[model samples]
Target: METKSIVLLFIMTAFLTACAGNSKKTVQMAAKPIMKKHHSVVSQYPMSLPPPVVESRMRTVEDVVNNFGPYATGQLKPYFRKAGVAYPPREVTFIALKQEKKLEVWARDGGEFRFIRDYDVKAASGVTGPKLWQGDKQVPEGVYRIVGLNPNSNYHLSMKLNYPNEFDWFHAQREGRFDPGSDIFIHGNSVSAGCLAMGDEAIEELFVLTAQVGEENVKVIIAPRDPRLLPLDPEGYGLPSWTPELYRMIAAEMEGFSDAVKVSNNRPFYPASSPLR
Candidate 1:
């Protein structure tokens, strides 16, 4: 009976030992997954540098060019060829004329810029004037720059605009208007609330061109009207009090491009010629 009891006691101790070993092993197993996840995964909000610069992008700039470059180049190369300018000139300027709903492309050729081509704005939002506050639905007017290029845009692809720029912020701050809206872009698709919609084909061309020219090499100007034609008379326009000064600045800047020989809306647009484009 004593021998039988010893054997039973040994079995109980062995069973306890096995349970303890399993508990430790289960903890190790649970911890292993957490360690692997921490080391090998991206966070919910990825803080890494954007891809092509990094290895994170499932799609890269090369993919965009390959997918859309052929068609864009097909349409764009001719314009450059006709201008006697090399494709992807040194720099490019885009002028957005709100009243006429036209976006003109200009390229730097020897020392001055020349008119390359123009694209019809697919859609526009708001009336004439500058965007002031959030939800104002007014297209911003001023010299702007491309802030970024988005490939996964809901509207195909989009070029981000630096709206609420220093000029915008200065006015908004003076008027006590915080939240002077943002996320403005020149994107594809014929829809806009306060952005420039440049359709699929046009945006694709722009996207490819911008990627080639380098965002820093691109400039943008949004104007209320063709200041080169009709005088920018800010009188009685009932905008901001300082708007006349603004109109003068816009008109003066436009005079630089007054010489570009072009046809707008199938109508001849011949402004007084300037040495500049």
Candidate 2:
């Protein structure tokens, strides 16, 4: 009986020891940081584009403005002051030229669109039209969001946009092909194979603009031409038939964009703020 009891005790001790060892191993494994499936330095920010996906970086003002004259001067100042952005948010505008296959930004107050500057691009596999499908070889049309931004990236600085939004996904789902790549960005001038690219300087300006707008305020308008009608006479420009439709669509979509800002005759004004001021 004594021997039997002793054997039972030994067995219990061995079992407990094994359990303790297993617990330690489990804890060590749990302590390891789990990596995201596509985590990158440039994809760190929640809004804006990053270089990890786009392969772009920030550049100085001289590179963007001195080379390309701005569409409007000092227009960026209000946004800069309002957002307390460092450097001069005082003079910058983003230009997306479908015909030129280029996306550039310039610093200016206003005068002429001589800001004929050009930025580097990665792989652009689209034409001057709206992207309809995943493998359509066309960049998207309409306004989109820079929902993600990152400073550290596999390529360089970059900002990420919520490409293939709900509308895009819905369309894809209907076609029974849901395997769309989600990491599209406005990154450094690298080969996209299917993405848009902007030079380092232009991206920097974009970063500043996005930071000021709180990402939510950042609006990307890819149009056929500059809307200001600087080079062409507004009356004689003879816009395409699709132009009016597009404009109306945008205006309708922007309706009720701001609950506080009231629109009277297609103009927006903040009623909460005093008119006396």
Candidate 3:
């Protein structure tokens, strides 16, 4: 009886030991895939780092402009003083009106922007509408920003706009549109297919100003017309259903800079000697 009891106890202890070992193995096996998945995810999308500072040795758009004709920094000094802003403004906003053919430049002063100057758009294709497709010959009417600075451009010095932004992409995706087209620029030359042609002289100043202020700090607002002065009437024209809503969205953004225009009345603030021709 004693031998049988000891044998039963021994069997129970062996069984419990086996069960514990199996449990540990199972846990390790389960954790292997989880650890692998974590590693895979980390490898797939590594953390993004901030952009590196511009190297002094690398030739910049500002350096190129300085070597050209008039120095943009020198030309912008008087205008900056009149607007009560620092030289080579920290932030710059460009309001491009399609119908009016005007490009208003505003510089940041303290918390608000100060009206700088207006440049005439030498030429722009399409009448008055947002660009929807390739070869549409339409100048897009939306909020944009300077994304690229092309010193070696066919149309002289040019600054590229990030067209088809997140909003544009969303609309295109919703409509199942594939080719929205791209390469929109505020370039030089009087001839343009679907770009804002500000002429050679105008682009030089703009290009330099953009480079100096940093492209990330520049904002470009393209509108069908000056929404502040003229009301947008999509009903008046045969247009897409989304046109009116788009106009209202643009008007809302324009409202933020309304005070800048009011203070300067959309007139060139530079002195007579330093006129924006």
Candidate 3 per-residue lDDT, tens place, 228-274, comes to 76577666455666888888889988887764454546443322122
Choose the strongest candidate by lDDT: 1
Q: List the residue pairs that clash in candidate 1.
A: none
Report RMSD (Å) for each prediction in the order shown. Answer: 7.6, 17.4, 15.0
Q: Please give the distance, in angstroms, between residue 178's alpha carbon in candidate 3 and its true position after superposition.
A: 0.8
Q: Per-residue lDDT for 243 in model 1?
A: 77
Worst 10 residues of 2 by lDDT: 268-277
Top TM-score model: 1
lDDT of 2 at 41: 43
Q: For model 3, which pairs clash? A: none
lDDT of 2 by residue, 114-185 (tens): 232335444455544445555655555445677876665454557787777775566557766576546667
Model 1 misplaced stretches (Cα beyond 4 Å): 1-58, 236-238, 263-277
TM-score of each: 0.74, 0.43, 0.71
List per-prediction Cα lDDT, in the order shown: 0.82, 0.49, 0.81
Answer with 1 or 3, whichever has the higher TM-score.
1
What does the lDDT come to for candidate 1?
Answer: 0.82
Which ranges in model 3 have alpha carbons more than 4 Å from their true place?
A: 1-62, 259-277
Q: lDDT, candidate 2, residue 247?
A: 46
Against the correct fold, how does model 3 do in TM-score?
0.71
